[model samples]
Each structure stands twice: as C-alpha cells, then as structure tokens.
Target: MLPPLKALPVFEAVARLNSFSRAATELNVSQSAISHQIRVLEDYLGESLFQRQGRYLALTQEGKNYLDVVSSSLSHIARASNQIRGEEDTKIRIAVYSSFAVCWLMPRLSDLQHKHPNLDITITMTHGSPELSDKTADCFITTDTEKRGFEYQLLYKETLFPVCSHAFYEQIKNTLNVTSDELSKRLKDEPELLENFPLITSNGIYNEYTEDWRSWFLERGIPLSNNIKFHKFSHLILAYEAAKYSLGIALVNDYMFSDKDTHSALVRLPSHRIYTNDHFFFSYKTSRRNETAIKALKQWILNEASSLNTLA
Candidate 1:
C-alpha cells in the first residue's frame, strides 16, 4: 500500500503549479520522480487526480477536493514547524541602562529565575536609547517616556542619593563633621579620593538623555569644578562596587543597594532626595506577539511587575 504522506510534496507542488515539470523544478527533483509519485498516489486513491491536456495538467473533481485538504494540512504543518524552531532558537535580549541594572534588576533577578528556570535572558548594558526597532534588544528598559508599540512595565520609580562604604565614611567622619561646605571642598580638591572612587556617572559618553554627575551636583546647589578628578566606568555596577570598596563617594541610585549582602556596603550621604519617575518596559516585535515565546515573556513580566507594584 502506498502512503498518502509520502506523495504529499509531489501532489502539493503539482496542484499549486498545475504542471508536472513545474512541480519537479519547484521541488528540485527530476520530472520522472514527480511522475512516479503522482502515479503511486493515483493508484493508492484509485482515481486519476489530474486530467492531462497537451503538456498541461488540470485538477479533476477528485483532485480539487484532495488539493483543498492537502494544501490546508501542508500549510498548517509548515507553520507549526516554523513556530517550534523559533521557540527553541529564539533569544529574549533585554537592554538596560547601567544604574538600573545594578540597583534595580540585578537584585531582583532571583525572582525571575525562581519563576522561570528554563527561560533564557540576555542582558546587555546600553546607555540611553536601546534602539528597540533596530534589533539591538528585544526589549528596552530605559528612562525614556516615548516608547511606542511596546508592552511597558514600570519596574520602579528611582530615587538617587550619595552612597559610600562604611570604611570610607569612617576615614572621613571627622572631616565631614566640620561642615557640609568644607566636606564638599575637600572632595573636590582630593584627587586620590576622586580617582579611587567610582563617581557613579551614568553615561560612558555624555548624551543629553543621560543623567550626569554635574546635573546631580547642580540640583544639590553644588558648583561644578574643573579640578575634580574621577575615573569613569561605563556601567553602573562597576561604579557601585568601586564605592562599596571605599574608592570614592558615588552619587548613585538608591535602587542598586542590596540589604542582604554582608560584604556589600553602602551608606547614603547627607543630601536631599533626588527622585526621578521613569518607566521600564518590555517590547517585542509586533509580528512576534503571537509567538509562544513572546507571549510567555509578556505574561511573565506582567506577573512579576504586578507583584512588585511596579507595573503600569
């Protein structure tokens, strides 16, 4: 007995083009192979599926009925196969700004892992404008307000302040107690302190979108100086650690500090609260919304964000 499945490719191609030679060319097989498959299919069905006229082939009544079923089934199989392959190989790359990665997301990553042990997450530290459409990241976690066609989930509204290590603070306590102005002057003049301390500057390159050390100091009514010496590390976490090790006082987001790490030390400097309300969102390609992985991601992010009271 001949199998219907074995002849489906030949049948489908011939049905589509209405010619045996054309079907053979499309399937990348010899014309004789196409003829043999069709003959086998016809014998199995006990009916002539196509009517030959000159060199052309036309579907008979039986052929038309079979073509409808076979074509629909083949299309469905193709779609299913593609979906399965996409799910296995697909990566959900998320681009996040430095400070947020260190202070907000990194601490909470365990929660995501507990919920989705098998899901793959690719995190890249990108400064300002993750460029979602350009395929830089599947999702962007940014402070930007104008994100279109993305499923925006507000992770947290950040509050920024000064933080330094306990050991670093102890070394400067007598000096800091003199007066706020005197301490500020000392910090500005001390080149070694600045060099050792990760100043916790947000942007590697200055962009209008990024929050800067000068902006934060200006907001606090402190004047900017040319003599202030500090090393610039591109990402927020590196800066955070530099401060944690007593390198220098870093004006950083409050969100990056973890209460649980015994070795991790951070103390907020005496400054007024610096608050910024920005939302982070998960965005997928619009065409990919229906895919299983995309759907899974959307639901997972929504659920996690909701519990944290960060979802918008």
Candidate 2:
C-alpha cells in the first residue's frame, strides 16, 4: 500500500531541509512534531530513513532512493490538487485581444457571469495572435477565421463605419454646407478635428492592412493630404474612447459599438462606409472540447450567435 500523502510531505520537507527543527520552523510546526511524523513515516515504510550524524540527521541509502520518487510524486500531487480545486471553484483563464475585450467583450461579460454565477473568469490581453503552446489561458477570443489546432466557434462578424462625437459635429457641422468631397478636405484641415486630435490606430492588430485616415478621406474622392497628423493604437477600443470624447473621427467597426448610449453620441460621417472581414471567434484546445465547462460556454456562445444572426 502507498504511504499517506500527509506523512510524505513532512518527510520530504525534513529530508530537504536536513534538519527537523529548521523544517519545523518553515512548516510552522514544533520540531518534536516534525520528528514524530518522520518517525511514523519511516516506521510505515519499515526502514530507517535517517542516520544520526554529529548534530544532524542524514538520509540513509534507502531514504535517498525513496526521497527521489516521493518528492516528485508529492510535488505532482500538490499541483494537480490545486488545478482540480481551481476547476471546482469555477475559475477560468481567458485570453482576449485587447481591442475586442474593451469594445465588445467587457460590456457583454456580465451576461455570461449572470448565467454562470459560480464561474470566475480572469482575462489577459493578447496583442495580436495568442501563444497557443503556452496554455496560459484555457480559451482565446480572436478575429482570425483560419482553422487552428483548437475547437473554434464564430462569435460575430463586423462591418466598418465612420463615427464622430457630438462635439465634433458641433464644431464642423457648418462644413456640411460644402460638397461631401470638399467637406472632407476642409474638415481634414481643422486642428482640433485633424491635427491636434489623436487618430486611434490598430498598429499590431492590422499592421499589414492598416486603416489610414488618408484612405478614408480619399474614398470620398478627396485628395490625401501631406500635412495631416495621425496617431495609432495597439487596441481599437482605446481609439473608440478617444473618438467618443471628440478626440477625432474613428473608422470604428460595428461590433465595437455594443452600447446604445455610445452609439447615440456619435453620428456616421457623410458617404463613409467600409467593409472588412474581421469577426470575433472563441477557441479552445481540441483535446478540451469535450470538457464540461468548455462545452457549456461553447453552447452558450453558439446560441447567442445564432440569435444575433436571426435578428440581423
């Protein structure tokens, strides 16, 4: 029969520390208690595990061999127990793209919590693609449609639109008197609207296919300017906040505007619309697809997507 795990920990601690009193100090137990536990453990094993030296205890040959196996087994048990407890406690680790987290997921997260009250979801931000090999997170929220090594479900697709704050409109609503092309050019020249205002950018998220202010203006048949100043952001939501506060106009994707209140504060600029293939997707390691918690979340996300599509 295997030895009790409780005894093995005390024995391992005493063996590593090489002094029962020191081990007791570390474990917050009396030296006599530590010595008694070790004695019980050695008796149970039917071996003298320690040899008396000048003023200390040394591991016997049997003790050395047993220590090698027992130490490893005990450490493994501790880690596994912690993991099981975490799962039982309904703790979940999730990795989300910063842009999606701020603009879309965060506002809707309470819905998930309300349904799964026991679930504790902790999120970490990924700059672009998350490292799948790390397993730091059990799930990831991404925009890529490509098939990964994990089970995946599409959350939502997004389209692009021009949005500006109420303050921005109040300042440039007079420019609306000109032709759409002329208005874009004139508005592009406003220091508050164009020069001083920060343009939220997706530097890493869409570096290969960056959405540029000049492209947005040129789409309206206006000449791209050389004097215009622009700024970029790693996450799109940061840009949304800047735009919401009248920092400047942002070519926000539709999914980012999750709130009716935020939507009402901004007006879509004239003749401005763009299409992109970006969409939110949830993914998990393929081996974990059958896990109870993963299956639960998967079903909920799919049901939500289906309902959203039906409404659309």
**Stretch of 10 with least lDDT, candidate 1:** 189-198
Write candidate 2's Cα lDDT for 169-256 as tens digits.
6555554455556756665563233433445455443453235555555556666455555556655676777777887777776556
lDDT of 1 by residue, 37-124 (tens): 9999999999999999888678999998887668656644665787677635344667877666666677778887777677688888
User: Which 10 consecutive positions of candidate 2 have the poorest summed lDDT?
Assistant: 190-199
Task: Provide the lDDT at 95 for model 2.
Answer: 84
Alpha carbon deviation, residue 47, candidate 2 (Å): 33
lDDT of 1: 0.65
| Runs in model 1 lying further than 4 Å from the true structure | 1-91, 98-107, 124-128, 134-137, 144-148, 177-202, 205-211, 225-231, 258-263, 276-279, 286-292, 295-312
TM-score against truth, every candidate: 0.52, 0.58
Give the Å error, residue 204, model 2: 3.7
Candidate 1 displacement at residue 288 in angstroms: 4.4
